[model samples]
Target: MSKPVIIIGAGGHAKVLAESLLRGDQTILGFTDPDASATLFEGIPYLGTDAIIFEHRPEEILLVNGLGSVGDNRTRQAMFSSFTAKAYRFTRVIHPSAIISHIEVEMGSGCQILAGALINPGARLGNNIIINSHAVVEHDCRIGDHVHISPGAIICGNCTIDDMAYIGASSTLKQGVNIGKGAIIAAGAVVINDVPSYTLMAGVPAQQKHQLQGGVK
Candidate 1:
């Protein structure tokens, strides 16, 4: 029997994850958030703050990282890491509408493949990654840890996205392009070349706009 899951957050993304779980018929226990009065889908119980999770015990309930992403993923990554350090296991949530390859695609823990996403064959994805609604990861793409492919983003064939990178909504990457760690591709940008680490890129042809800091190695 699969373990019952407790979603960890009460934000918009958390609600979406709940819907996915419900659609898939997974066992859902409840949810947790900082706000004691937080409400969830179908009136799922508010199980108090994150501190209340200690009562459940790691071996008993699986965890789902329900935090959403606007760009940076450090907080989400940190949440997964902290829970796993205490021997907690994270459950991967895949929406029924998302399409994924049946072969040559390896996805790591805490991955959320949301509604309307299409992941082509031979793509390898890492931990705590989110392939948001309507995003397309084309053939043989390699995505590193904590990467978020925002809604409507298109990653072309054989692209490499390094750790903690964020592909903004509606952005398009050309074939074989490489995105470096901590890089942020601004919304609607079109990328044709390799982007450097810790940089922010924006525009029709995507140019480096600013330098950022602190990404996973």
Candidate 2:
């Protein structure tokens, strides 16, 4: 929460956050990406590899987790944990257009509540979370660390989404459902029952299609 911030990745998600930040007084120092040519914006300078972040002291600047997570969040989670271990705190990116019904909710660090997203009362969100554009988190939902609630995803009331679970775009979770750690819900899936850890849930009324691997459980 400072004057200037450095985005950790250069991608579509990074650009979206950049536009929102630019609307306010938030100054983007630069972005770190391995491939500089991939940077789309003209103004934001391209900082070299992610290692370049160490050039600045942790207290002087705030960092943003610009890495977008689809179904897997291990890479994003790792990046955040590495910096947090060194006492580098990531800034919260709450888009101006988002609607939050509760002010007393427990929201952890490095979370992005994006444009048009709606969070109802009693939602406790954990670190490195992305409540993507137009997504809905209903009352009393418990969302854990590094979770990616994709664009247009609807998480119903009293749902408990454990750490690193990926709720895909346009997916709907039934009330009181529990999505275990590292569970991957495919796009448009309707999750009615509880999904276990490292499981791949897909289709309407989501079925456990396979046991997922390479996920951070």
For candidate 1, write residues 77-184 as lDDT tens digits.
899999999999899999999999998999999899999999999999999999999999999999999999999999999999999899999999999999999889
* Candidate 1: residue 136 lDDT (0-100): 99
lDDT of 1: 0.92
Q: By summed lDDT, which 10 consecutive residues of candidate 2 come out lowest? A: 208-217
lDDT to native, each model: 0.92, 0.91
* Candidate 1: Cα lDDT at 95: 98
Off by over 4 Å in 2: none
| Residue range with the least summed lDDT across 10 consecutive positions in model 1 | 208-217
Query: Per-residue lDDT of 1-217 in model 2, one digit per residue for the tens?
Result: 5558999888899998888777766989999988967684788899888899999998888999999987889999999999999989898999899999856577899899999999999999999999999999999999999999999999999999999999999999999999999999999999999999999999997998889886632
